[model samples]
Target: MNAITQINPGIRQQILDAFNFRHATKIFDPDRKISDEDFNVILEAARLSPTSFGHEPFRILMIQSPEKRELFREFSWGANGMMNGSSGQLGTASHFGIILAATDELMRAGSDYLQDHYARVKQLPDEVIEIFNGAYGKFQAEDHKITSGREITDWSGKQAYIVLANMMTAGALMGIDSCPIEGFDMARTTQVLAEDFGIDTAKWKPAVMFAFGHRAKDPEFLKTRRTMQDTVSWF
Candidate 1:
């Protein structure tokens, strides 16, 4: 039998508390900023997140420049409601991030990207690489039934969300507030990313965006959730 490590029971309560403490914070205290050490820990959490086939088909772009935030603010309708005067999460948050997911060309099996990834990054032997390619190809074509290019990109986006959630939860555990934003014009955002940020939109597309900071005001409403019986079923 494998060795089983002991875990503290109280650690579960602490995790629950952190989850309860977290919410989609709107406006943030502009004066307060997250220290580099703390933010690095959060980034590390994202880096350590798991991805399908260990192919980390995502990238994170940290938007710390005020000019870039302003450019995003012009197209981000989700953050507009939270704007205090001229600033919202984009303007006030201590840190902001955009998650980009790899496109079909990079995600499809037997692609040059996966070939290099399996060889160099994953360090798999040639035989193993051949096996994985077959398995992964079946997963993409048959198991998942990916029909269009968009579906492949969407699959990669699902992996990116894992990183996004870990980053936000890590911040929450550290007493930092965060809000995930998806309300933006995709075309406009893509244009800005290509023309302004100089990202290769063909290879990677924006999946999601989020902001982290200290909340300017505590939420007035209480957190609500469905009962376990209603939300989950046991065999």
Candidate 2:
């Protein structure tokens, strides 16, 4: 059945409950692992997330091997910051997802990469396709004028956050806890990915990371949130 047809009152409530149950989990149960089936579902949610202009700018690296996790843990501890030092979550969590954003070269208009991406949507008249490409080029040019390609990373990184949120919510729906990690040193992370995984840093940059597992126990802090009226406004 389609999503619209399935959204009855019960299903709607379940959706809200999923959001309510999710939190930035600080402590994870080291022994508990998310089943492969459920983990795939979470990944699927990220795969299907929306991106601006259909650029699909994010790449996800799932780090689950014990040795690799140890490498990341040591890196996080060595990074100079309160947040990095407190990253026990990375060491103990069952899995880590590193989100990387595509570099300017891949997303540049008229590049073979983007042309191939746009061509796959559907066959368009040549004139229409030209118009689309021109518009995209103009947009990128304007973005570059303002930030000199730095905005490419910023824009692509924003898309990765969309995937991150979707994966976290999908995991929550499956009774998995998640922590959105933004405390690591980006330069060090880029170095690690290049040295260990052979990922080319010039082509893709690490945008963010996340930890997933079951929560060790109830959090000491209660759920404190602003009411809908306080945060939302009507037209």
For model 2, residues 1-235, the per-residue Cα lDDT tens digits are: 6665555788888888888788887767788988889999999999999998778988999887877766666456422123534447766688887999988877767777777776775456677778878888888777445234567878889999999999999998888889888777788888889999898888799998888899878777778999989999999
lDDT digits (tens) for residues 4-59 of candidate 1:
98889898877888899999988889999999999999999999999999999999
Q: TM-score, each model?
A: 0.95, 0.87
Clash pairs, candidate 1, are none
lDDT for each candidate structure: 0.90, 0.80
RMSD of each: 1.9, 3.9
The true-versus-predicted C-alpha distance at residue 46 of model 2, in Å, is 0.6
